[model samples]
Each structure stands twice: as C-alpha cells, then as structure tokens.
Target: MRILVIGGSFGGLTVAFSLRQKLGARHEIVLVSKEARFTFIPSLPWVAMGWRRMADISFDLAPVLSRWKVGFVEAAVIRIDPAKKQVHTAVETLDYDYLVIATGHRSANEAVPGLGPFDGPGHSLMSPPEAEEAREAWTAFLDSPGPMVIGCAPGASCIGPAYEFAFEVHHALARRGLRHKVPIVFVTPEPHLGHFGVGGFGKARQFLEGEFEARDIRYRTSAAIASISAEAVQLVDGPSLPSRYSMILPALSGVRAVAESGLGNPKGFIPVDAHYRHKDHPAIYAVGVAVALPPVEETPVPVNFPKTSNMTRQMAAVAAHNLAADILGGAPVTRTLSAECILDMGDRGAHMFADPIRPPRNRSEMSIGRRWLWAKRAYERYCLWRLKRGWAGPASGLLG
Candidate 1:
C-alpha cells in the first residue's frame, strides 16, 4: 500500500515519521509539501522580539525525510481528488492508497481589512517572515513608545500568542525601564484567559485575571474586532479601539488548498471520526487545525474550538496506527486527546496540563504553576531539539 501525507508541519511530520518507524519498508510513504524547511512555529514570538533569529527555528526537511527512507515531494498541493485518490500539485499528480491531510489552518488575514495589508500590513508573527516583520515593528515601537494593543479577533483559534506577546511586551518594556511610558493592552475573543484556543484551561480564568491586574496590562475580552488601520482597531460592537500600533492575531480558517478539494466542510475543515478517519471516506484522515473541532461548551459568543500541538499529535498517532493496521491486517486503535502547554511570560511563566479535554462526570480541570518560567524554557528547547532529530516519540514533547 502507498501512503501519502500532505503538509509538513508538526502533525504531518509526526504522521510520516511514526509510520516510517512502525511500518519500515513494507509500504511506500510519500510526503508532499511546498516549502523545503520545517519551522518550529511556537518559537516565532521569540524571533519577533529579537530573542532568536529566523534561522534558529527552521531546519532543512530533506535530510530527515531522506534519513527515514520516506519519499519527499516539494510541491504545493493544488487540489485533492478523493474520488480518484490522487493529489493534484503544481508539478505532478501523486496517486495514493491512503491520504492524511495535515494542512493546518489557512490564516484568515483578509477576514479583517488592514490586518494583512490594509495598504500595508504593520506586522505579524504567525510565520517566519511575519516574525521578522514583528521584530522590526518592535524595534520601531521601542524607539517611540506609545499605547499599543495586542488583539485576538473573533474566530481566532490560536489565541494564546496574543496574550503571550502582551505579557512579554510588558516584561520587555519594564526591563528597559520604559514600561511606564508604554501602555500594553490585551484584546481577545475569549471571555477569559487560559481559554487558550481550547476552552478555558483549569483556573486559567482566575489566574489570568489576577495576572493581568497585577501586571497592569489592560484587557478587553469577548472583543470582536472588525478591522484595523495603522493607528487603531475598529470593534464590531462599538467604537474604535485606539492605539499607536496594533498586533492582532486574526481568526484562523482552513487553507484554500483543502477547501477547494471538495473534501472540506462548510468551515473549510475536514470532519473526522474519533479514529481520525474522514467521515465519508475512511481511507482519508486529517489532523491539526484543518480538522473541525466542535465547541467544548457553548457560550454567549461563538464556539471556542481548541487546536493545540498535543491534540494534533494524538490524532496523527491514531491515523498512523490505523494506516499501518490496514497494511498489516489488524484491528485499529483509537486514542483520546488531552491538552498540555507552558505559556511564557518572558520574566516568568506558568506550566499547565489537562486530560480528556472535556472530561466526564465530576473530574475537575488539572493545573499547576508558580513562576515555573524556567521549566517553560527547558520545554521549548527539548521539543525543537527532538523534532529536528526525529527523536519525537516516547517524549511526545508537546509545546503548544
């Protein structure tokens, strides 16, 4: 059997790498990706703040794929024809017996005008180049400090970064003795912090509320920002939020590549069963942000769907095991996803972990923290180090 996995980020690579070790040379596995490199994206904020450079977060993908004896194709997937079981690319069409889509999220930049390039985009840290842009923006902001906002818009799945940036900015400015000169505000669609991109983490509501107050960081939760200009963000509900410059994390939707493939749902995300198989097509599976997550619990606002790296890996593991099972003729195993992460505050941070996501019965949320900031740093280094070396299993070092 031939297995083809698309997208080369954490989820896709996890699927490919796991299959390589488990299946050996029994089946052909091919990975299709446009870029030649894999970036440790969670570290992009450090790059943006000039704490790390772009090169440090990125490593060549060709070497790892070759080392594992997996086929690598450097081409953008233009379309996925599930009916034909083939992928259309800019270069050539690749046929597959099984397909795993890990295309992540298609950043909805234009969902808000001026966010991507209202005339010109101010800055972003979603990708490597965006991180560098943010670095330059931070430099200019430091030179002329002013009231600033780090906004997370409605429908935004990756909401943690905005809070991280806001907190880090506060710490950065304080180190320079210019914190009083700069007003740092946190704007988010979640009603509370630690809501993370996943509903609220345990005690995150109380913990973040206290932190924001103590840190003197102005916060506006449940905000649905409509648009942004060079000077301010126009809110959907009321008046424009004023600022000298804004770094807003716009909402995330599925990538157009998957959406146009006719395999995606109305939200451009694929629907997968508990085993990670596509609902209508069992031969296909999906992981990461490209798979739609139902709301954990309904709120007055829109659904708060969580998509963390830990959850993505669990989904990939199930998909890989099932794919291997089909080739080996055995029962497939399914696994439930949990949440884990270390949020950096620069000066100090927190470490939190949870299980079963939406746990059953009376079990409460699991969490613990007390300036385990050093632990967060160690976690980040270990994750990047393991993935680059393909030593990702057993550790499963999730750095969401």
Candidate 2:
C-alpha cells in the first residue's frame, strides 16, 4: 500500500516513524513536508531562553526517514483531492492509498491588529524564527531593565506558553540580579489561569491567581488584546497595558492550503470522526491541530483550542492504527485520549487535572507539587533520550 503523510512536525514525523516501524518494508511510506528538519517544539522555550541551542532541538529529517526506508519529499502541499486520493504539492501530484493530514496549526497572527512578523512592538514565539527573534528581545531586556508584557490575543488557544514565558522570564530576571528592575506582566483571554485552554483545571485557576500575587507578576484575566503597539497593548473594553517589549500567543487556525481547499470547518480546521477519518472523505485521515476538537466549555470569550502536540500524537497514533486496520481487514481501534499535560510555573511546577481520555461529563481530576515538577522534568529528559534512540517516550500521566 502506498501511504502518504503530509506535514513534518510532531504529528507527521511521529506518525511516519511509528508506521514505518510497525509495518516494516512490506508497505511503502512517504512523507511530505515543507521543511527539511523536524523541530521538537516543546524545547522552543528553552531555545528562546538560551538553555539549549537550535541545533540541539532540530533533527535532519531526510537522513532519519532514509534510515527508516520511507520516501521523503520536501514540498508544500497546495491542495488535496479526496475523490482522487491524491495530494497536489507545489512540485507535483502524489497519489496515496492512505492519506494522513497532520499539517499542524497555523499561527493566525493577523487575527489581531498588527501582531506579528516582529514588524514593530509585536513579537511571538510560535516558530523557530520567531523564537529566535523573541530571544533577541529577551537578551535586550536582560541588558537593560524594562517592562515586559506577555499575553494571548482574544480567542487565542495554547495559553500555557504565555504563562510559562512569563514565569520563566521572572525567574531568569531574579537569577540575573535584575528582578527588582524588571516588571513582568501577563495577559490572557482565559477567565483565569489553569483554564489553560480547557477552562481552569481543578483549583488551577486559584493557584495561578495566587502564584502571580506571590511572584509580583501583574496579570489580567478575561482580557482581550485588541491591538499591540511598540510600547503599549490595547485591550478591548479593558485598560491598556503598557510594555517596553511584548510577546503574545496568537490564535491558531488551519493551514493555508487546507483552508483554501475548503476542506476545513469554519475555524479553518478539518473535522474528523471517532476513527479520525475525515468527515468529508474516508480515505483522508487528519491528526493534530489540523483537526478541530470542540472546546470543553463556552467561555465569556473564546480562549481555548483542543489541538495540542500531545493530543496530536494521540490523534496520529489512532489514525495510523485505523488505517492499518482497514488495509488488513480488522476492527479500527478507538480510544479516548486523556488530557494529561504538565504546566511549569517557574520555581516549582504544578501537575494539574486528570480526565479519562475524552473526559467524562465536565469532570477533571488534579494534583500539584514540587515532586510533580521533578517528574515533568524527568519526562522531558526521558523523551529527548528516547527520541535520540529513535523511540517515542511512554505516555504521560494525566496528573503527573
């Protein structure tokens, strides 16, 4: 069978690697990506903070895929025709017996007025290039004390990074003996912290609220960032927040080509069924942020998205199993992926929330501690080591 995978980020690379290992040389596998390297996105913050260099996190894709004997192509997918079971790239049309779309999320920086490309006061850490730019800005801040503002625009998803950056900055400043000189502020559209794009996990909201108070980090919850200028961030119906430099997590939408092909939902994200088969086409399966997973709850304003890297991997694994099932004539595996994520809050991280995969009835369980933070760190190291050895790490606990 000819299996073609699109996008080379977490979902794409992970799925390809796993499928190759599972199926061996019996079936042909192909991977299409715009870039020649795979980035471990979770390490981007460390890269931005100078804890690790870019090369430390980036791995050459061609060689790795070659070692696995999977066909690799560096081309941007321009369109997909489910009827034809083919993906049209900028170079040529590639046919697929099974298609997996894992193009990842697109940062909709333009969603807010003048918010990206580092054109002015606006900056982001969503990509490798942008992370470098933000790093430069951070270095400048370190050399000279200034007011720092980090936040998310209205309706933005992936709120965890904003909190992480804010806390990390504060910790870095304190370590540099400039904590008193630098003023840190955090802004987000979520009603409160721990909401974490899933509506405040357990007592997470209260914990985050108190954490900032103790850290002397000013924050505004339920705030919608409207426009960002060189020295100021304008919030809709809220007081303008001042800053010398700013980094905000923009809302993520579907990829340009997927959106252009009219294959995605209103949010520009594709929709998939329980088996991860595209609702519009059975041959096409989508994993990762490319597929839209409904938000857990309705908020005062939209501030969450269901698509995350871990969730994306789960989605891709499910897609791979189901696709294999179809080819081998077996039952498709369907399992709910539990929401197990660790959020770092500076000195000590907190482990919050445990839900059965797909959460049962507005229910989420959680626990917090310094031990959990250590465990999270252990997990990161374990994952890096495993990846280096060509292995995907074990599953993370929902509340570890």
Candidate 3:
C-alpha cells in the first residue's frame, strides 16, 4: 500500500509520522509540498517584530522526512486526478493508493484591496517574505511613528495572529518609549474580543477586554475593512482610521490546485467525514486548514472556524488511524478535536483551552500571566526539537 500526503507543515508531518509508527514498513508513505522548510507559523508575529528570525522557527523538510524514512518530493502540486488516483506535480506525476490533502491555505488578498504587503500599501505576516517585509516596515515606522492599525478582514478565520501582533506592538512601542507618541487601534470581524471563531472560551472575553483597557489599545469589533490606502484603513460602514502602518489578516481560501482539480469545495477546502475521509472518495482524506469547517455561529461579520495547530494534529491522528485500518483490516477510529494555545503578549501571555473545540465543552480554561510567556517559549523549542527528530507523538500534552 502507498499513501501520498500533500503539504509538509503541521498536518502533513503529523500524518506521516503517525502512519510510519502504526504501519511500520508494511506500507510506503510519501509527502509532497512546495515549502522546503517546516515553519512554525504561530510565531510569525514575532518574526515581523524582529524578535525572532525565519531560521529560528523553521527547519528544512527534506532532512526531517528522510530521518523518518518517508519519501520527500519538493514540488508544487499542479493538480489531482482522483479517477486515476494520481497527483500531478511540476516535477512529475505520482500515484497513490490513498491520498491526504493537507495543503493549508491561500491568503485571499483579493478579498480586500491593498491588503497585501508587496502588492499594496498594507502589510501582512502570513509568510516568511511577508513577515520580513513587515519587519522592514516596522523598522521604518520606529523612526517616524504615527497611528498604527492591526486587525483582520471579514471572513478571516485565523485571527489569533492579529491579536498577538497588536499586543506585541504595544509592548514594543512602550519599550522604545514611543507608546504615548503612536496611537494603536485593533479592528476585527469577530463580533467580540476572544470569540476566536469557536465561540467564547471561559473568561477570555473579559480577560482580553481588561488587557486592552490596561494597555490603552482602542478596538472596533464587527468592523469590516473596505480597503487599505497609504494613509488610512477605510471601513465599509464607519469612519476611516488614519494609519501610518497597518497589518491585516485577510480571508483564507483553499489553494488553486485543489479547486482546479475539483477535489474540494469552491473555496478549495475539502469536505470530509468524521474520520477525515472525503465524502465522495474514501481513499482521499484531508485535515488542517485544507478541510472545510463551518462557522460555530452567525455574527455581524462573517468569521469561519479556526483550524488551529492542535486541532490539525487531532485530525491527523484520526486520519492516519482510519487510513491504516483500511489497509490492515480493522474498524475505523474517530475522535473529537480539542484546542489549547498560549498567546504571547510581549511580556505576558494567555493560556486558553477548549475540549472538543466548541461550546458546552467538558473542560475549558483561560489564564493570563507571565509564566505562560515562558511556557510558550519553552514549548516552541520543544516542538522544534521533537519534530526535527521525527517525533510526532501526543507527548507534548495540551501545548501540542
């Protein structure tokens, strides 16, 4: 048996490792991805702020996969021929008995004019280049500081980075003794702070509100950005916000390859059943941001469900189990996803957890303090060390 996994980030690596451990040498596992390195995307805001470099959070994917005995193909996937059970890449076409689509997301910069860093006046931290560009802009801003805008566009599901950037900016400016000179404002499509696209968890709303107030960061909730210009961020229904620098998280859509191949929805996200198996093709499975997930509830502005790293790991485990079962002869396994993340706040941070990912969960907690900051840093190092050596087991606890 052979399995082909598209993507080399959290989802792909986890699936590969999980399968290698479960199936041993009985089946072949190969991974295809455009990125040569596995970057810790959650730390991108720090990269933009110059606190961490790209190398600090990223490692070459080839070496890691080779160490795990998984075949590695560095190529951009052009399309998938489901009927033939083949995946076409620019380098070559590969066949597979089973396929796992974990091709992350494509930032929909077209959703809002001037929302991209290189293409427009706005800045972003989505990719390595974008984060470096934002860092350059930040360096320039320090010389002549003014009003700063940090927020997310409508339909943005991955919003934690925006919040993290805002808080980090506050700390950065204060450290430079420019906090009073430059006014900062946070805007988001979420109806309220701490909604996190999975509904409110514990006292997150209150905790974030308190933090914002103490830090003197003004915010606009349920706000939609119409466009971004050199000097301001115009809202769809409200007044424009004057800004010298801005970082906005745009809406995310599935990659063009998946959409063109007809393997996913119109937006490119694959539809999957409980076991992360494709509804139409049992041999095809998907996890991570590549999977289509509905919003938890309706809000004034659209906000899709967040596919956090922790949730993606859970999906990978379940998908690996089911795929192995099909080949080895066993019943399928299914499990609910749980999320836990520590948000870095410059000097302090917040630790939040949600069992089952949505409301009415059995266990949920939110805590704020400086210890979480240390814990986050420690966990990041731990993750890099573990994944570098091809250990993807669930030993990292809730931090994973």
User: Which lDDT values do the candidates have, in the order given?
Assistant: 0.78, 0.78, 0.91
lDDT of 2 by residue, 1-400 (tens): 9999998777887678777766768999999999998887776776678776788777778877887788999999999887788889988999999999899888887778868746556878788988888888778767777787888888887777788788788888888788898687788888776677765567777777888899899888888888888787888898777778788889889998888888899778998899899997888888888988877767887876656677777777777777877876778876576577776666777765546434443557567677876887786676555555555334311111
Off by over 4 Å in 3: 395-400
- TM-score of candidate 3 on Cα atoms, chains taken together: 0.97
lDDT of residue 308 for candidate 1? 79
Lowest summed lDDT across 10 adjacent residues in model 2 is found at: 391-400
lDDT of 2 at 353: 51
Candidate achieving higher TM-score, 1 or 3: 3
Instruction: Say which prediction, candidate 2 or candidate 3, comes out ahead on lDDT.
Output: 3
Query: Which pairs of residues collide in candidate 1?
Result: 195-200
Q: Rank the candidates by TM-score, best first.
A: 3, 1, 2
| Candidate 3 lDDT tens digits, 1-400 | 8899999998999999988887898888999999899999888898999999999999999988888889999999999999999999988999999999999999999999999797789999888899999999999999999998999999999999999999999999999899998888999999999998999788988888989999999999999999999999999989999999989999999999998999888888999999999999989999999999989999999998999888898898889888888988799878878889999988998999999787789988998899999999998898899889998768222222
Clashes of each: 1, 5, 0
Error of 3 at 57 (Å): 1.1
> Which candidate gets the maximum lDDT versus the true structure?
3
Lowest summed lDDT over 10 consecutive residues: which window, candidate 1?
Answer: 391-400
RMSD of each: 2.7, 2.8, 1.8
Error of 2 at 313 (Å): 1.8
